[model samples]
Target: MKNPFRLPRRASLSRPWRWLVPLLLVLLFLAVLIWLPWQARQMEANERQEQLIADTLWVEQTLRFELARSEEALAVLGADLVSKPPTPEQLQARLNQMFKNGHELRRVLWLGADGAVLAHHGLELPPAGLAKVGRETLEMARLTRAGRYTEPYGASAHAPGMVDYYLPLFKRGEYAGSLVASYSLKVLLDETVPWWFAQDNDLALLDRDDHPIAERADGGPGRGIYTHRRALDLPGSSIVLATDSVKGTPRLLPNLLVGSVIVLALGLLLSLMTLWRHISRTLAAEAALRQQMAFRTAMENSLLTGLRARDLEGRVTYVNKAFCQMVGLSAEELVGKKPPMPYWAPEAMKDYEERFAGVLAGTITPQFETVFQRSDGVRVPVLVFEAPLVDSRGRQTGWMSSILDITDRKRA
Candidate 1:
């Protein structure tokens, strides 16, 4: 007969799909790991660009403010000269005071209405290059009759980067002389750009032609530099203030940290995947074992043979439903009962006890005939088969008995 106790075969795991899932997960994790650091660097570069632009604007505003202050000072002096023309002694004294206070101004001049130098300060002899101005620039000042700044130019043989500030003086509605102030580009940058600002970056004041008038000696922008430029709004001038980060845009340590975090996350994900695989296999095995146990239980319940088990000391440990029916008792009443069991006939109690004692001593019988009294006091002849109940370690821990009632066969 086919063994009905055999369990159904468990479904096999899909090995390719099983490994492919984690493989795809690993690939995704690696993609994110690769992308994170690049993203961080790009963001850092953008932030650096923004910061450079802001610094350029700040430098532009600072230069504008300083130039305005200097222009106002020249306006005051021009007012004094127009209201009452001073003596040569008074002019020299006032100019000396102004030069002492304003270090950015390299020279000062009083220009006649025809652009001829009337008086000058700061240099014993003015360079030949400083004698004339562009007629168009001079005419603009004369027409505006207001303070204006000239485009940056080589002011003297000694100073290549100087600009002239002009304040046209008008006395009684007639054009008078003009008060001119020459500003040194180097001196202006020194007074305008902060010490801290120049430490981390290279700053430069560029003329209209993009020629650097004054520059800080922080190394030029190499690879990965962020640069920004803003115009310094001065009258009749197109001066640009520019800044650049000398050490490049993205910082190294932060990018390294971001990469480290991504690596750790990938490692953690791999660990979780490993743990999940182990758990999945374990659950599959448990399900298979449970199914096997359920099949065995169903086969045992359907058996016609009576099954009984006794521990090493001859105490009944287990009895199946068929055994209870054969003894005319419930399993609860028969299981855990000792030798001289309730179903043993009163006259055969001594014989049954001796047989049970031999069974506890490891004696086994393949088959024997016995008589058991039912609950109604009727005697039933039964054929019994006995065997050792061995555990997984091959140790005999108990006895198992199979019994078949044969009253009808005996009568026939």
Candidate 2:
């Protein structure tokens, strides 16, 4: 009989790709884990820069609007001076009203063409203080004969960092004098910078030389990590509005959310791979067991020896095909049959019964000769080998026998 438990010769033991695919997937997840945070930070930086530019432009436009309104006020004053020059008391009253209405303006002055101060409000500058106007400012006023702003100047006892807006006055197209409006940089910034913007950033007004004329008082100097500056479109002045972030830029929350998702996805993938591997191993083991059982069944079916099994109670429990043919009986008729069986020869029945009793009591010889009466009444000689049928725990549960026909050998 063939050995039923032999393994197939060509079966492979190694499966490289099984582990390699999971390794590659892990690598891909790690790449995403590293790359996604950086991408999110880049996007955040871009958005911050755009916001800075927008804020700078807004400051510039706001400053320009305030200056334009101031200039218009000065133009109206200039027109009134050209039409009907007011008494000192009347002029002082008008200047006080103008000062109350214009919170950013430090002082308003009416100067004679000879550069002498005729009247002023909001500051008690001495008559000699009118000479503080620079040569460039005087020259520009003389040439343009139009309203224009002057270069920024350092803070004085009366005003903190100042710039002067001059509207050249004319009587019948003849250059008459100048109506001057001096703006306090501190006051201008306090009014121009929006409250919302001041909450998150430090804004400063800079002069042509990049000197800060005014800055927000709410915080100390900014870190300058995110800074933006833009020029204000004011005539005869090179003023810049600059802004800096007061605190570090915040990280995007979505990046954290995305990172968590990536981690979860990686875990899910690894878990699925593990489950698949376990299932694959289970299936492979099941297939191998099924194949082994099939091989054993085939080997048993092809055997020429008659095989039989008897329970501890001495009743026939199993018989192979050869056993049925040898006795001239079908397996259904032989199985479950007790001793004094149909195939037992009448003359040898007592000897067979004694041997069976000895076998059940574990004292019979392992090999012996026996005789059975066939269906045609012929006595067949046989040689039988007996062994214990053991269960998985190695406890004997029954007796097994392999019988070989020895009638021909005896006849020869």
Number of the top-ranking candidate, with TM-score as the measure:
1
**Residue-level lDDT for 246 in candidate 1:** 75
TM-score of 2: 0.68
Off by over 4 Å in 1: 1-47, 123-133, 155-160, 219-224, 251-261, 287-305, 309-379, 383-390, 393-398, 404-412
Clashes of 1: 0
* CA deviation > 4 Å runs, candidate 2: 1-26, 126-133, 155-160, 217-220, 252-256, 265-412
Estimate candidate 2's alpha-carbon lDDT, on a 0 to 1 scale. Answer: 0.80
Error of 1 at 348 (Å): 5.4
- lDDT score at residue 197, model 2, on the 0-100 scale: 82
Error of 1 at 2 (Å): 20
- Cand. 1 Cα-lDDT: 0.77
